[model samples]
Target: MEPTRLNKYLVDAGVCSRREADRLMEEGRITVDGRRAVLGQKVTGNEKIFVDRKPVKKPESIERVYIAYHKPVGIICTSDPKAKDNIIEAVNYPDGRIFHIGRLDVASSGLILLTNDGDIVNAILRAEGQHEKEYIVKVDKDITDEMVTSLRNGVHIGDDRPTLPAKIMKMGARMFSITIVEGRNRQIRRMCEAVGLNVESLKRIRVMGIKLDDIPPGKWRFLTEQETSALKAALV
Candidate 1:
């Protein structure tokens, strides 16, 4: 077989997405035939591969799984079994190993995607993909015109660059809905903080066209065939 990029190989094996595979390589958590894997390396599917010391199965052997989960507050979005309140334990998916597509802070809750298909994960999270994620946020004080303007115009959230302009609508005195294309660490909270607001509560309600509708907190459901088809079509 032709050699494959290590990242792509990992993605095909259901280990992680290409970006995550790169991070794992940088962190020295991936080994190729007992040697630390190098960024951008390629493998022929013959050499032994391990991620964090666990042997990785061949790509062809992986069975893809995808599901939408309504994460509740206090459930951490991590696969590490050692972490307290880890999402893996909370979901206890019976099929097989799966990882979250993105993250919601422990204090926040709502729609999250879990999957063993790293290709889809990579497509949805691609920086240029600009996939929309909608959230309902409640702040400590009343929403204001100035706050709306600043957020809609984009705010510097201590990152190298200011956040992209977001779609915002005031839903109530202390609540509003926001749609953003980028996913930064605690981005919505930090954006609010930048505009002199404090988030009292946050919940994601949608990703692209996937709605959190009727998925009670702490519950999940597999994506319908139509929903999955539409999502992949959008990515294409």
Candidate 2:
């Protein structure tokens, strides 16, 4: 409740981390009391603050929300309204402003989480790959046991380093379910490509312990009480 630094205030507002707050301040993107904020400036906890002209209100207690969206293929996982077919518009959520927790690529589809609660975002994403993300994928060609084992062992997907071990389950001739802790950009596709398989389609079915279950494509629902509690416990 005391006076807080601009960076800390931004973090509390669930906008960004203290370091990112400093960068935004330096970029002249943040304003306090109608003036561009300077580095290390402190807000009196009552002065008005804005980031890119959007007001920032740090609440002592904030209502938390979590959504399980069945993101459709070709929809982007970004808050930028300028983007074509962005998730926010696709979901048409009438609730207050919120952002997606993680991303599901434009070409890929399925369960993606969105929330207004910043603390949960920080807690879950701060650990990065510590959480689980499960996907069902279809490759262009038949998948062999060797390929599955190789994928589980780890593959150098043209990145600077190899990926960590992933859980693999063969579902069909060309279909497989894989779970990974880390989420590099287009990681699943890249991993398959490394082993000479081209991905035809991919769908993320789960994150943490939450699942898409029977949620139809393009529909989203608020996480249930038990689902939310389990997610928090998993993060712990």
Candidate 2 residue-wise lDDT, 183-214, digit = tens: 89999999999999999999999998899999
Candidate 2 ranges beyond 4 A from true positions: 14-29, 38-41
Could you give me the TM-score of model 2 versus the true structure?
Answer: 0.88
Q: Candidates' TM-scores?
A: 0.87, 0.88
| Candidate with maximal lDDT | 1
lDDT of 2: 0.85
Which RMSD values do the candidates have, in order?
A: 2.4, 2.4
- Each candidate's lDDT (Cα)? 0.90, 0.85
Residues 161-216 of candidate 1 have per-residue lDDT tens digits of 99998999999999999999988899999999998899999999999899999999
